[model samples]
Structure formats: C-alpha cells, structure tokens
Target chain A: MTRPVTSTDVARRAGVSQSAVSRAFSQGASIAPETRRKVLEAAAELNYRPNRIPAIMLSGRSRMVGVVVGGLSNPFYASTLECLATSLRAAGLQILLVHVDDALTLDSALDQLLSYRVDAVVTALAIGSQRAARMLSDLAIPVICFNSRLTGPWISTVVSNNHAAGLTAAQVFESCGVTRPAWLAGPVRNAASRARGHGFIAGVRANSARWPDGVLEMRGDDSYESGYDAIRRLLARGERPDGLFSSNDLMACGAMDALRQHGSLNCPDNVVMMGYDNIPQAGWHAYGLTSFDQQVDCLVDAATQLLDAALGPDGGPVSRTRVVDARLVTRRSTARLI
Target chain B: MTRPVTSTDVARRAGVSQSAVSRAFSQGASIAPETRRKVLEAAAELNYRPNRIPAIMLSGRSRMVGVVVGGLSNPFYASTLECLATSLRAAGLQILLVHVDDALTLDSALDQLLSYRVDAVVTALAIGSQRAARMLSDLAIPVICFNSRLTGPWISTVVSNNHAAGLTAAQVFESCGVTRPAWLAGPVRNAASRARGHGFIAGVRANSARWPDGVLEMRGDDSYESGYDAIRRLLARGERPDGLFSSNDLMACGAMDALRQHGSLNCPDNVVMMGYDNIPQAGWHAYGLTSFDQQVDCLVDAATQLLDAALGPDGGPVSRTRVVDARLVTRRSTARLI
Candidate 1:
C-alpha cells in the first residue's frame, strides 16, 4: 500500500512551515496569499487533503451530530430522517448516523455515538432506559429526541401534539355519527401511540351519550402487515368498527385494504378511517386517507433550534419540551356519511 | 461551561501515569488488571470519555464508511439503506451519511466525506462527472457505487442486473399476449432506468412480430405523482397501452391508481403492470403489484464484501463490478390472460 501524502510533505514541497500548510486548508485561518497559493499547489500535486480528525480533537468539536434512527420501512420515519439531515446540513453539520433496529441495539448505538464524541444527538427512537439516559447526562452531551420524549437534565424533546390530533380524530368520528369507533394502537411500549390512544378514548367517552360502549383497541407493530392482520382478526370475530383511528398512515392503508377485501365494507360509507402522520401515500387516489400531518418540517426546525441553543457558546445543561401542532388533512376516507 | 475531564485528571485520581490511563481505556492494550480497575473507577467519578478522534488520527483509519443516499420517499432506497446499515454495523464499522438531494449537492457531500477521511465510500447516486471520479481515485479511496455503476480505475460497483430484470418484464408482457405496451422510465440521467428501458425495448423487438408497433415510452422522476401524471397524459392523448413496465414500484402503484381512476381500465385484466424493486407495498392487498425483487440482502452482502476486500491488508486500487440477479415476484398485477 502506498503511504498517504500528509501536511508535512506539503510543507516541505511548498517551502513553508507545517503550520502554514495547515493554515492554507483551515477556513478563516490567517495565511499570506503567496504562501497559501504555494501550499495549494503542493497539496494538489501530492493529492494531500487536510484531515479534520486532529483538528476536531484540538477544538473539542467534531461539527457532527449523531442521528439515530430506525423503522425506515415506515415512510414517516424515512421522511423525518430526510428532513433532519437537510436541516442539519444547512447548519453546516454532518450526520453520524446510527441505525438501530430495536431496543437492544439502541443501547449499543448510543455507546458508539458517545465513542465518536458527537457534538449533539437527535434520535427518532426513544431513549427508554434510565441507565442510558444517565450516561448521556453525565457526559453533558445535549440530546434532542425527535417525535419522542424523555425526561433528563440534558435531554430536550420536540414532538407533535399527538394527543390533540387524537381528539381531532374523535371529533371527526362524532360529527360523522360513527358509533363503535376503534383505535389501532402501535406497540404497547411506544409512548406516542399511548398518548394518542389515551386522548382518543377520553374524547370518545366525553362526547357522545350514544357511546355507552368503549372504543375497540387493537395493537399493531406500526407495520402494514400488522394492521392488516389486526383488522382481519377483528373481522373474523364478527366485530365491525364504524370508525377506525390508526397510529400511522401505513397501518391505516393496510386496514383500509383489509376492509375492502372483506367485500361487504367500504370506506367512508360503512366505516370511516383516520390515520396519523400524513405520509405521501395517504394522498394516493386509491386511498385518499385522512391523516394528521405531524408537520415534520416544523418538528425538525424545533429540534434544530434546540440543538443550536444547546451547542452554542452559552450552551448549558437545560431540559425543555417543544410540541408542534399537528393539523388534520381531510380526504375521502374520512368523509361525512350524513 | 465546565471543562471536560481529561486523561490527566483520571490518571491523577487513579494514582497512575497518563499513558496508563490511555492503555486502560484502549482495547487489547497491555495494562494490569488492578490499574485498569482504578482507571475505570476514576473515569466513572470524573465522567470522562476517551475521545476517538485522536486515536483515529494516530491510526489513520476512521473505521467509518461514507454512505450517500437520497430519495427516501421511495421505499426501495429506504430498504436498501436499512440493509446496508445493518450489514456495516455487523462488521463493526460506522456510517457517515451524506444525504444529497441533487447533483450539485452531491459534489459538496463528497467533499465533506473526504474531509472526514472516511475509509470507503458507498454511494447510491451515480458518480456522473469525471472530475469527481478522479478526485476519489487520486485519494486512493475505494468508491463503491451501490445499485449504480461508474467507470473509474478505483471505483467498484455492486448493483442488480437491471437489464435482465427488464427482459423478464418483457417476457411477462409477451406471455400475457399484450398488444400495446408502454415503458415508464425514471429520470433521464438515471442509468438503471435507462438500462431497464433498453433491455425491455430490445426484448420486445426480438421476441414477437406482433410487437412491431413498438413500445410507448414515458419519462418520470421515479415518483408516485410522476407516474400518475405520465399515465394521465398518455390517456389524454387517447393512447391505450394494454401492458406497462415501470422503473420502480412506487410509479407502478401510481400508474395503477391512475388507470383505475380513469374509470375505463384495470390492472392485469385491462393492463398487466410490471415494476422493479418489489418493495413491501407491492405485496399489499390493495396493489398486489408484480415487480422484480432486487434481493437487497444479496446486494448489501456483495457491496460489503467488496468494501472488506478494498479496506483489507494488501488492498489495492482495484476496479470491479458485481451484479446480483433480480428475480420477478409475480402477483395479480401481471397475471396471464388466456
């Protein structure tokens, strides 16, 4: 293997000091124009690119944010990552991405992020364990949980107003005269699903006296297959839901398909469907799914703002929660029956 | 802000030398068990973390692979990223992700990756310009174009045999006895889409004299809306195609919705549709679209194997291309009619 050209080699070739070679590559660093030209010429000839690792060590800043994400199959998460990446990049920061598959991997992913000494962390996954949370807090690294919340001195949260969105779904159901409404919840451990479900059930109980029976709740893994199977099992039991609220758009699409395949049921005619996270597929002519737009751009903006504040010169260990409002986008799936 | 604890602080607290503190933190470093235990205790007390930046500089290996991706709205790309991340993580490597939105941003993203001194780069986007290709080659960085191909001395490619997949689509159309067929291609610069379109056109010309009328061609941005608009325009021109081959499954779904919404045509019965990248949604009961499975796992395996070989000892600037076979997953969308 050939040895990589270093700044020292460029210094020798340019007839300048090593510091001069470094200054030529360092942005905003002072260097004479003639010396800078000489250094660049030598660098181009030797193919010597200035390395950032040692500079990062010296400055105590990597200018890299650790972004931990998973569930790419869920378009919502994928979209969230895209927004976060763009927002971070615009701020002149790079993303050191850690893709965690599950809870077990989340711990190790956090460890890897810590080893890299990321300036900050923005995670789509929830930091579930207190041990992990405490570890991050001890290091004084600012963490901003995107679309998820955790309580810690060093952790901040930016999430959608999921509870209010659920209430909006219930209001839509009531206005449509939908009785026996069902709530399709994500995993039992998912906090966002739980909050949405709680608000929906509460609204259902408070609104209609015709609703003596509580809403039917089915748990899914926030996957299309899970949603499809959940509805299939419900139908097999001869139970029909007049209205359905899903935790995400993907699951709602699956439920809609399952209902259509049942042959007797039709959307917005026999049943109304509402979903969270207004993903792109929801707008397809085939689905026209009514969903809550989590306003990913707003969420990303809030997260980045928090990141900036925490990473700024006056940055300190502070914890705060920012909730962005989610608006409901009505489509054919949730059209009024009356 | 409080100053971060350094190795000197830990060494002082542990009654050991600073080098001993580093050795204790380093894996496989020669250190006494008692000394290591003392260093750990002091480190815990001081909330100190051994920074990896300096170690990376000393070893000249970042253990990070730069992964450039875009089009997360497409499930195919999302799935590909998940597979790559999982495979790379298993090999104990981290990913420095660069999310490029377009060609202009792609150059800057590569520069960022270069400044990080990434060990290898795997890009989903085509490295189009000769200058960019030459830059990577000059740096002796092993560049692997995932699901894309580029010709350079240092560039390796791991992609599905898209042309063969196109031929398979043509065969399906022929067997279905389709008289009029159309090819929906992606962006003009996309090589994969061009290859598929070429193979499909070639196969159509070679196989059936009944196809002398030739296949209609439409261009899209590999988006759902693009496919929908392309079909709408074709229909507006009073051009009716009995068969359709889409560059991606998302566009296929869009085209399917458009046909159904037109109120005159349907899938398989009216128009047998074929798509590439059998994403999760392809199996949904709603679409049940027939598409080619790129076998993401196989592609990821090949890419990682090439990466391993390139980053291994005795590694050279070798160029090669490994093509994974893509198989057709038949569904109701392309069912044969007697």
Candidate 2:
C-alpha cells in the first residue's frame, strides 16, 4: 500500500550519508557507534530493513557457500554436518547443500556447485583429481576438502590423522595378543581410507610377530554388508583373524555382527574389533565399539573459520593442510588385552 | 575477459523470445522440445549461460524452497534428506535447509527463511501453533508438513501410518507369545509417537489376555541411552518385559544391548525386540532388529510431486494429507513364535 523505505530514506532521517547507513547495518563495517544508533533508530521507526542483495553486490561476494557431502548413511558424517551447517550459518553465510549418493555422482554435484559464484566450496567427499582442484583454484574459489589428504598446493584440506589411527588400531589389536590380524579398507583409492590401512600395516610390521605375511588386507564398499561379507570370507580360511580393524564405524558394526552370526564367536573373548570414527553408536550399550574419535566438530569449525578468513583478511585463497589428532575411545567391545 | 553472455544474447541469436529461453532451461516448464533444442544449440555455440538470478527475478519467484528439519541426530532424517534434496533439484528448484535444534530457535530460523520470500515451506518438524500456520497461509505460502497431522485446512502433510506400524509391533510380539510386553514411546506430545503408542495399546488390548496392565508402557528421550535405561528400569521391576517394542531403531538397539550386558538375557529366546523406522542399522547383522519400514524414498518422491502440483496447475493451496503404508520387516531378533 506504501512505498518501501530504503537506506537512503534512513540516511536522510538520521542526517547521515548513505554509506554511513550501509556501514551501520553491515557487521564489522567501520562506522561511529552514535551514527549507527541514529541510523538504526530511524530505520526501525520507518520499518525499513536493508535488502540482503545490495551489500553482497557491492562487495562482489555471494555470501553463500556450497557444501558437497556424501556418506549420509554414516552417523559420523551426519553428526558432523549439523555442526558444520550451524557454524557456517553463524558466520552470516548460507549453505547450498549438494548430496552425492555415490562416487560417480560426486563429480556432477561438484560441477553443479561450481556453476554458482559461491564464496567457497567444501566437500566431505575425497578429491582425488588434481585437475579438479586446479580448476576451482583458477576460478578464484576457495576449496576446503574434508577428511582427505592434500595432493597439490591448489586445494586446502582438514583431516584426522588416519595414518596414526591405523597404527593405533594395529597396536590395540596386538596388545590384545591377537594371533591373526586383518584390516578392512573402504574404496581402493580414497586417500583417507588408504592412509588408515597403511598405518595399520605399518604398526603391525613394527610390533607383531608376523610382519608382512600375517597381516591380512580386506577391501570393503564402506557398508555394513561389506564388513559382514569380509569377515565371512576371512573365516572361510583355515585361520580366522582374531583381531579386525575396520576403517569406519559402519563397517566395524558389520564386522561385529559377522563375529556373532557367522563365527558364533564372542567379542573381546575370542576376537576383538576396533573401528575409526567413534560415532554415537560406539558408546551405545549395545555395541560399545572401541574406536577413534576424529574430533569432527572441531575440525569443521576450524574449517569454517578458515573460510571466513580466506574471504576477508586472508585475501583471495591460500592452500594449506591441517591434520587433527584422533583420540581412542576404549569401550567394552575392544576392551580385550591378552 | 569478455562479458558473460546472457539469456538475452542467446534469445536474439536463436530468434526467440527471452521468456522462451528461460522456460527452455527451466525443467517442467511448458516449452516446445524443438525450441528447447534450438536454444541449447544457440547457447552452446555462443558459450552462453543464463544468469541464475535474472530468470527468477523476471518470474517474480525465487524458485527456492525452505526446508525445516529437526532430529538430524536420527539416521532416518539424514537418509530422507538426500532423496528430498535430489527430487527438488530435478524439478528445477533449489533448497534452503534450516536445522531446528530446539523449539526456541525454530522461530528465528523461520523468520530468516521468510525474509527470502521462498516459494514454499516444507517441514519435517511438528507445527504446534495454529497461528503460525495461519500466518504463513495468509502470505500465500504453501506449508508442507511431513510426519505430522494436518492441524488446519492451510497445511499439507505426508506421513507414514504410524498407527498401523504400532499395531504391527504389538501383533508380532503377541505371536511370539510373550508373558509380558512393553511399549517404548518417544516425546509424550509428539502426535506421530502418540499415534504409535495408542495403536500398540489397542492391538495388545485386542489380542493378548494381559489386557491393559500387562501391556507395560515406557517413555524415552528417543535416544539410544534412553532405550538402554528404559530396559534397565523395566528389568529392575520384579517382572521384566519378555517382549520390547521401541518407538525407533536407535532405542531398540540400546534395549538389545541392555538385555545382553545388563540382564544377561538372550535375544529371540529370552526376549524379542521390534523397532519402528527400519533404518540401515536395523538390517545390520549385529542388531538384526525387526522394524517397520516407512518407505522413505517413495514418501519423499510423493512430497516433492505434491509441492510441484501445488505450485503449478493445481491452483490454490489445499490442506490435505497423504499417508504411506509402513511394512513390517521381519528379522532374526524377532523370529521366535509361540
């Protein structure tokens, strides 16, 4: 019924320049507190709210970020997403979420995200292609790769020390005096998965009696069924792995089931299971799965803060990698030692 | 270095109206296939991309939907979100996701979403206030409520037959011929949870000689620990429940663990467990939880399609509800029969 009031109207009423009015509404903008108060008072009286688009347009920024996440089936990712989404929203940025159901669909999701002039791109999926990183970097888009190894200087990354986690799994199993050991890995080329598996092998070589020959390697599709099947196949052999290390909590859950139904073996009595990513279920009285905690919330928060800096004080984009420590949570399922 | 080509430029080259070009790129838009093919060829030859915002502005629509979801802590929500997001995208729309952590913060999230004039609002959270629904409807905003009852004629809803799911749980337990049966319910006021509990009670009253008192009732925080503690409390009583029905899979898993460690009771032999919402974990060998399947993908597809029709030729917003059937998934944990 009436013309909508603008920053100009507020500026005139407050006896301040339009730029001052803009500064008053913009967070971290430079303006005198008294002038800001005056502008806000006038704007409120006139029932005027600043349009969100103009400020972003003036700054040549979208104030939006694209987040590509996969593995929603995993509780760890699902939990981490809550924190990540909240942290970004708190920073005054909106998240355009893209879900990648599978590896092939992941690239397409990334491409769809790239079509937008997003301030930054974050991915829970691993980035294996150096070319992809370079292309995003060329577009002046800051890319944050989560739970993946940094391959080149073009992309930034944050990950738990999967390599060390692997070693911990192996040592925990060895301390339990397991005669046979196996490591179940997800997807052959995932940097994080590979790191965890290699770390376990390295640890086994350092402490176990059977260096290379005794260590068994199992590949999984990162599903509970994969862990279930891997164990079923492992038992078909003359010797069964007394200790098994699963790359993630989901697979570890499967391995635990396999021990119960297939082998009719009891956990921590005849066998022990260790998993990475101490998801909420790890503490559930049902499983009490001993696993490594990735400190996902902390990592995601740090990544969000870094993206903020990259957009502002840090200048365009800088490539760096940060690895956080993974803590071992000792629970009943992995409580056995000798 | 050159200015980005616009839809207008492509429109001119293709000898078509700009509106036609816009509709050609828009999915589900009424445009000729021949015109769409010509537009694509012209756009490709000129290396043009329609600016993401201009078309939306021209149509006076954001082509974006605001999704309000709570209980991301539940695997069911995360699993459903992927399908919902994809379905929306395929229909030429974008999603703005808001996570409702608590009721107090829900209003603020809604306020922010409303500021954008989103084409519609879809929520998985319960809308308790009639005034809130009326306000949105007055603004010509179509509200799609998931897993909630239709409170008013202004709101549309999609939900599983929670009542049927409850009855299924009770029948399965009765067939197992348990001396004592118990039902675990979520928040006392949640309509879906209440529907499930009442249905279970009704079924027990019909089938079992125990009638009302013998069918024990338990309430939980809908967490694994809550289920764990619920079972512990039930066992502390002189007569432990021989059959347990958890409102959700998470709590059931906890109940199962409590049976093994806390009571030294065996599954399917000493006690039988049935859960609702057969999440991915229910099928895992460790739990083998017999649960009700909500058919999330089908439900999500139906919701998306409803939103489409509401926005298109379907005319004015209609307050209606659709209920999808919940099928019983039989598993090892609930295999024992009388």
Candidate 3:
C-alpha cells in the first residue's frame, strides 16, 4: 500500500509553506483566501485530512476554553453555563468542561484543565486560592470568571452588579412601606453575596432613620432546603419580617413556600419577596417572584469581548472587570402592599 | 536564554525511548511505574513540562469526550449534564461541551466536536439524521446517547425505561380509582416520550375494559408554559382529567399550577398528577409531584461502562443499548384518596 498523504505533501503540491497548509485547516487562523483555496484544493486532490492535534501543537493554540463549573442544580448557574457555551462556540472556541463538586475540588479541576493546555479558562466557580491564581498567571493563561469574582493578573470577571441589585431591592421594599426587612444571604464565602448584603444594608440605613441596625440576616448555603429552613426557623421564633430579599431565586422560592406552608402568609399581602437571578421558574404562575434579571446574554457578550481582546493579536493578558447592571422584573411576589 | 527541554531530552536523560517518556506524562497511558518515575525525575531535573497537545498528537488520544447539550433551562437536562461531567472526569476523561440552540444546530455542533477529535461523544439531544450517524461511524468514534435513543452502528445508548415508567404511571392512576385519565406527551419527535405514551395507552387499555378508546392525549413541546397552556385550553373546553401524567416533571409542575390557578382544582383531591424525571423541583412543598426517577447516576455509570468497553483493548465499535430501570417516587401528587 502507498504511504498516506501528509501536510508536507499538500504544501509541496500547493506550492505553499507547510504552515500555510496547517493554517488553511485551522479555524480562525489568518491565511489569505487565495492561499487557503489553493491549499484546500491540493489537500482534496491528495485526500489529506489534516489532524487538528498536530496543528494545535504547531500553533500552540488549542482553540479550546476550559470551563470549570459547580452547582448546576442551581438554575442560575446552569443557565449561565448554557449561555457561556453558546457564546464561546460562536467565537470559534469549544468548551473543555470540568465539573467540580465544590470549592474543595477546584484546585484539582484547574490542574486537570491545565494538563489539557487549553487556550484559556472561563469558570463559574471562584478560583479559591492565591496559589492557583499565581499558577495560571505564570502559565500566561487568561481566565474569565463568569458571574464569579476573582482578582489577579491575567484574570477578567464578568458579573451582574450584585451591590446595585441589593440596593434596588431595598429601595423597592422601602417604597412598599416595609418597616421591617430581612436578608437571606448565600454562602458565607461568596463574594457576590457579601457585596449584595452590604449594599442592601447601606440602602436600608440611608433610607430609614428608625433602623440603626441592619436588616435581619439569615445565612444559607444557596439551596432550596436551606432557604426554607432559614425562614421556617425564624418564623418559629415569632419574628416576622414584612419584606425579604434572597440572594438567589431558588432560595427565594423556598422562602415563599415556607411562608405559605408554615406561617400561613401569602406574598404581596403578607410578605413582599425579592430575589436575584430571574430564572425561568421565577415566572411560573404559582410563584410570580420579582427578581433581578442578570441579563445573561449581556454578561456572555461582555465575557466574549474580554476573551477576544485577551486572545487578539495585540492581546496582553490584563485584569479587567465588567459589571452588567441587573434590572428588576416586577411580578406578584413583590407587589406594593401599602 | 536556555533552550526548552523536550520529551526527546527527557528520554535521553532517562535512558528510555521517547515514546515511553510521552506515555509517562500521558494520563492513563500504559507505562510502568518505575519507568514513569525515572522519566519524571529526569524531566524535573531538566525543568521539562510536557505539553499535552504534542503528546496527544503522538498518542492519537485526546482523552476528551464531546458532550452536546440543549434545553438546559430544563432542570432534568441540566442535572443530567452535571452527572455526566462528574462521572467522565472521575474516569480521567475530560468533557468537551457543545451547546446547541436546537436540533437545527446539532449538525454544526457535531462538526465542531469532530474537529477536536474527541475520544467519544455523549449527547442529551438526538442524533437527528442517518447521515450524521453514518459520518460518526465512518470516523470510528464511539458515541453514547445519554437519556436519548439512537440506533446505528458504533453507537451505544443509555436511557431510562420510559415504557415501564409509563406503564407504572397508568397503574398508579388506576389504583387511585381514576375513571378519567389523561396523558400529556412531550415533543412529537422524542422517542422516550412516544414510548411512554404508547405504554400508558397500552396499560389503560389492558386495565380498563369499559373504555374501547384510549385515554385523552395532549401534546407539549416539553416546556413549562406549553404544559400550562395545554391544560388551560382543555379546561376551557370543560374537559377535566381526574388523573394526569406528564412526560416530564417541569411540565407536570406547570400543569399542577394550571389546575390550581385556572381550574381551582387541587392535586390528589380533584386530580392526581404523575410526572417523569424526578427533578429536584418535584419534591418542593409547592408541587410534591409524584415522578419516575430515571436514576441519573446509574445511567451515567452505564454510559461510562459502554465507553470503557469501546475504548478498551480488543474493543471494536459496536451497537449496544442499556436501559436502566426507572423507579417511581411517591408523593402528595399521587397520594391515594380512597
């Protein structure tokens, strides 16, 4: 049998450099149309299908973005991941997904992604330690944290303006004549949750003179069960807040259920509820929850724009943060009671 | 500046072949521990870090699996992807995720995955056409359809026993002393939905002799709004289903909300509801929906098993289907009234 054709043979046949042949097959590679056409013609004639792995090795660009994700059960993260995948694919990149159970396994997840030599990484989970961030910077790998906060050289963050969202929630509650308010915060270590909580307290303090202290805060692990139990336990103690804001929609839904089941309270009539992340379930007829729309498409657009800049010809990995405004979607859950 | 050390340099220093050095760095490669240790020591002394892309080029194994996903807004699909990612990662395989907007974009998604030369593919969407299946077969790629049914050469499918779940739903409804039963089917092209509908109809006919005709059927595109509207439209026509089974849990929750909000009917009181894919939302206090658990972990285990066989020694591309049994989880939605 005759030897199989190679990129070298194609280059000789097409009267172009072997690198030109490789570029002709690589997506998003810079090659003149005429040269690409000639190279393709030669490849077709010679029945040579260039393998991508070898081309990636030659160019040092795998054209793949590592995406590390956790907590997909949360609709917010799931939807964010879905949008990110679509946006990245449109940019001529594929997602190398690494799913971690929690923050504990994140280091290993990063190690695995690094082993694959992905062009860059976009994660929905926080890059936990300074050591991991330094390692990524050392490798000159650009990372974009989607909806998560991370600060370091060569790192970019695209997130919803959580602080603004919290301020808006507080203003809405005050406008509804809510004297007593409560805040259901997410996990303690979550930076976004902390920012939102701070903003909410600041807004409450700025608006009210009677409240020297901040709103009642309940901590949850960002699960539906946690949200339900938090409210249930608070209500059991005979302390009821007329207005409540949850850091996440899933928790807000759980809180609503708890109020109705345990406290015999109905939303809008009894307790006005506001939540972050306007997931699809927030609009269901059962729970018309008023939520902050993170504008997932806009977040994705900003992320891709940052990625493009970082991977561009004059691209030097730089630290940047793009904060998209969160808009409020009004529904029955937060209707003005007063 | 010092020249970068290569695998060849490591091989020379370790007194081993270059291929052995490559294998030593490659995850899950066949290399003796002693040889790997020697290679690692030599590489460390030389400050050599093996780039995975070049190793993949030499080994022809990218150690990556392509996962095509769609409709992540649906909780079931989102959770399924999470499980698949975790399982694949545990097996020392990375996931290359391709997100498609719908069936129309599936072809392009597959093309992108093919360019990456993924070791295998696991899709949540159907492999729509025979041409696409043929293309994958020609490439000698092993594809496992997770919770999807596709029959072709070199294809493996791991799906829940939909028909059995349907039959069980029918029996549950019958035992609840329901005279009027209704089946809400998912999209028309969905094989799992069709099988479940068939089995439900068969069960209805087998159990009830009085009814010559099968139960009433409603079609939905497997969206929450679609389920709500289908039930609302039927209710407008004064057709009330005492017993209802939705092909998916999201739609069931929608149907339940419709029954309560529009028809002023309560589940297990005015109507009993059953759903498939025991999503986390099903157990929410608001719904408490009885559903068939597809056993996501088992399905993932089976898919990975099939993948191992296809990629193992003496492994050849073959067509195989593994149907995991779907178990019914009882809740208030289907609680017996009699």
Query: Candidate 1 residues B70-107, lDDT tens each?
Result: 88888888888898998998887888999987621145
Candidate 1 regions with alpha-carbon error over 4 angstroms:
A1-46, A103-105, B1-48, B103-108
State the lDDT of candidate 3 residue by residue for A236-270, as single tens digits: 99988889999888899999999989747779898
Which residue pairs in candidate 1 collide? none
Comparing candidate 2 with candidate 3, which one achieves the higher DockQ?
3
Sliding window of 10 residues with minimal summed lDDT for model 1 chain B: B103-112
TM-score of 3: 0.90
Identify the CAPRI category of the predicted complex in candidate 1: medium
* TM-score of chain A, cand. 1: 0.88
Q: Report the CAPRI category for model 3.
A: medium
Question: How high is the CA lDDT of each candidate model?
Answer: 0.85, 0.76, 0.82
The candidate that achieves the highest lDDT relative to the unseen native structure? 1
Each model's Cα RMSD: 3.4, 4.3, 3.8
Candidate 3: count of backbone clashes, pairs at least 3 residues apart or interchain: 0
DockQ (C-alpha based) per candidate is 0.69, 0.41, 0.57
Tens-digit lDDT string for candidate 3 (B209-317): 7445569899988888989999998899988778999999989989999898874778889899999989999999999999999988898899899999988884567
**Candidate 2: regions farther than 4 A off:** A1-51, A103-105, A150-154, A208-214, B1-50, B103-108, B150-154, B207-214, B313-317
- Rank ordering of all candidates by lDDT, starting from the highest: 1, 3, 2
Give per-residue CA lDDT, model 2, range B1-338, as digits (tens): 24657788989999999999888866578988899988888876775655566445456567778777656768888788777877887876777767667521133455556445467777666665565565555545566777765345446788889998888887788778876888888876567788888888888888645545657888887888898888888788855778888888888988888788865688888889999889887887668899998898878877876787778766365777788998899999888746
TM-score of each: 0.91, 0.87, 0.90
Question: Which ranges in model 3 have alpha carbons more than 4 Å from their true place?
Answer: A1-49, A103-108, A147-149, A210-213, B1-49, B103-108, B210-213
